[model samples]
Target: MCDAGLKLPPNNEKLQREEEEVMHGANLTLKLNFPQYQSEVEELSVKSSTEVGYVKLLIGQRKGITAKNIRIFYNGTQMIDPMSLCDHLGVSPPSIDVDVYINLEHTIDV
Candidate 1:
């Protein structure tokens, strides 16, 4: 359901806007899960061109943890930074639903 006050753009204009977004970058909704934190889940809407590192930064800001302390996983495999969500998900669309796991218990030994 859309807001009653919200008005959709004209067909042509809407098409043009969509084309522009496709040319630039689309947005995606990702499910961020914190398995160690009560199975907490949060929905993150970000541009497809966004990197996993940025997502981690966002999550860290929300969780009050350092970005370097967060680990991201997709489909049970660890995700690396510098990889766009579009390339990671391998989908072409403005909207897509994907799940990502967050591990906060990772420790680094100096």
Candidate 2:
């Protein structure tokens, strides 16, 4: 429930090393929450540049849900298809402490 965004410590060697690794195109680890399922995906590794739509697709595939049925929200704002994590959070090379909400669409067939 932290909305403070990413806070980089001053000259923290461990964080510095991790930042360097990410700068070399290392994937970012995200904590994905699925409220309806009452579950969470801890440590979901993804590129900072990856699109929100693709992230939904990836999660959908893994969770056995349809990509079109997924909706992602950050900081109370709904994340659209083209926005990347960097764009949404407005920072990169991150140990981003943001919580993402996943809304699963419940469908009914006639």
For this target, which candidate reaches the highest TM-score against the unseen true structure?
A: 1
Candidate whose lDDT is highest: 1
lDDT of 2 by residue, 2-108 (tens): 78998866988888867865674446766676566566554567777778888888877776666777777666677788877777754454444344444434532
What TM value does model 2 have?
A: 0.59
* Model 1 Cα shift for residue 42 (angstroms): 0.9
Which RMSD values do the candidates have, in order?
A: 9.8, 12.8
Worst 10 residues of 2 by lDDT: 101-110
Q: lDDT scores for all predictions?
A: 0.70, 0.66
